[model samples]
Target: MSIDRLFPNLTEDNQAELERFGDILKRVWPLKAKHREKLKYDIRDMSRGLTTERSERKIDYLSEARFLSPYLTYFLPWNLYRMSRLFTGLELDIPDGSEVADLGSGPLTTVMALWMSRPHLRERRINFTCMDRAPKSLQAGLKLFNAVAGENSPWRVRTVKANFTDHIKRKADLVIAANAFNELDWSGRVARPQAEKLAQHMAGATTETGRILLIETGVRLTGRIIAEMRTQLMQTGFKPIAPCPHVEECPMPATGQGAPWCHFNFSVKDAPTWLQTLSAEARLEKEGVSMNFLYLSRKGGKDWGAVRIISEPFKFHGGRAQYACSHKGLTLVDHGEKQRPLFPGQSLVPNWPANPKTDLKSGALILPNTKEKR
Candidate 1:
């Protein structure tokens, strides 16, 4: 079926342009794709190839070159929106006039998006230092920054091609590691080791109430990774600021649900030519699911707990009612309570309760969050 038939009065050229839009957005980061398959290998290479101090460093310049692979092209169009939404619930206390250093700022998409989202912050003396060892990734980030913000922007931006191994002496109000931790698989077992180092770097902020958001990718919108993050942060000084509410970890996915039980997917509005054609045949087989794990701890919390992981429900605009839930993960304590806003379609469709309603908080869904799991 032709798009012309679906959307009338649209010229063939307009339809073609629309198709081109979707095509470009579908591309994934090619270099990351290879890294994903052999993440462990990449970590090992980094450890063996570079000096001990440099190899264990927080930021690396190689990530940018890796992102340049053809696979990453698909992420161009909606990458900004996706990342912004991912970090939406993050309520960090980044002080005014704070200079932020985005360590391992791959593609600069998130940094640019952050600036764009908080235009007011740009007005203040907020200097963003994108530190990474990868020249190609940093260059790409700089290009994106320029595209979003023309030659004359109040925000001061700089891209560093050096890794963070005592080479630079600058301290920042806030330090972040965006999507950089996932690269540990690129080298191997070093992912955990590298994350330990990165965690330390974020804690080394120069300003008062130093804050950090160790954003981890969800298995689409599931909460498992979030749990892992909580534990990792506890090992350090970090504590849970908030849960990536979109997909909070639930008990169902791990124990109750069957294989491939839960997943998530998004609509590609301007799908490129191939996708436009393929999407017609591309029935909604399953949704693309992911979860976010966040960790934040101040100077002294007395004692800290291990981070917990949970599986969250998938998120999207409009879909069938059935796709909106999985109660097998809900804890017994909150099992029969009034539905909170977190339940899917709670806002739109009223009186809809989670099926079975037996998910236990003990299982990754809810942890000892004195801060109330948001």
Candidate 2:
């Protein structure tokens, strides 16, 4: 069975709201057709500032209308779609009247994603504090959040103009930072120290039942940073709640040359056609979105003795294979031609052999458990 079968809720009731939000973005965008060319140009510049060119690090999106408009209309909605999909799959155990905080909340992207993706949360009264250094961004985000939340909503939101590591006065039940920390050390040279510092701040901001979710673009350096953060948090009594099966040292190599880091991809085929068109017009057409994320909690959850598929299927001479991480270590799981292929990030407790054979090409131990996984 594939991932959708194991998690039935994944297939149902997700895309409709996302599509509606796309329409909402279209209606709310300030720029008209006459500004289409300029919007595309701004989008290109935003892309360069974000993904490339370390010299453009000081570029501020909220301070300028040209950059902020593209960010709000194109980048924000796309990120919201990705975040909503991610939130849909996780079982975040938030109670009624829980206090939540969003760190480095660029236009409240994570909060909005939780609101849209997890409708069950809507019934519960939530107090949210969103923190960011940019006051204009916070103001704009509040406007957009209210427009989406409408009247008489059970949730209350407040904005704080502060740095990412600034002290949050109140500890929250859930803390979120999405695409936030990567900006601190973009070169990946000091990921360890940066992660350690971030872990300290995050630990101080959350309680015993608190859960912390951090997400970043699925590049190699970001993966290393996330993994390093995971190690730092685990050392401080936090435990992995998702995407990681064991508390043992991370098997995915983060250092050295030509090493493959762990990350997952979500298809954008289900995204609204208008959004896709808009993306193409901006010359940033995306077939799928990829991210590196880690969800950690002080309180432990069920321990699934399983292997998480980390990569898409690659074909060998006799069968197909994919990279997986488990308590044993990084593994290469081989599937017979007749067996169903597994999806990335899907976990299963496989029937293990006493002594697994190693594959020469991938340098990972081969798991021959080609039998149908539950």
Best by lDDT: 2
lDDT of 1 by residue, 62-104 (tens): 4534425321333322344344444432444455677777766
* Model 2 TM-score (2 dp): 0.93
lDDT of 2 by residue, 129-157 (tens): 99987777778878877777777789999
Candidate 2 accuracy as lDDT: 0.78
- Report the C-alpha displacement of residue 358, candidate 1, in angstroms: 6.8
The residue pairs found clashing in candidate 2 are none
TM-scores of the models, in the order given: 0.55, 0.93
Off by more than 4 A, model 1? 1-72, 164-168, 186-193, 220-229, 244-289, 299-374
| Count of clashing pairs, candidate 2 | 0
Consecutive 10-residue window with the lowest summed lDDT within model 2? 1-10
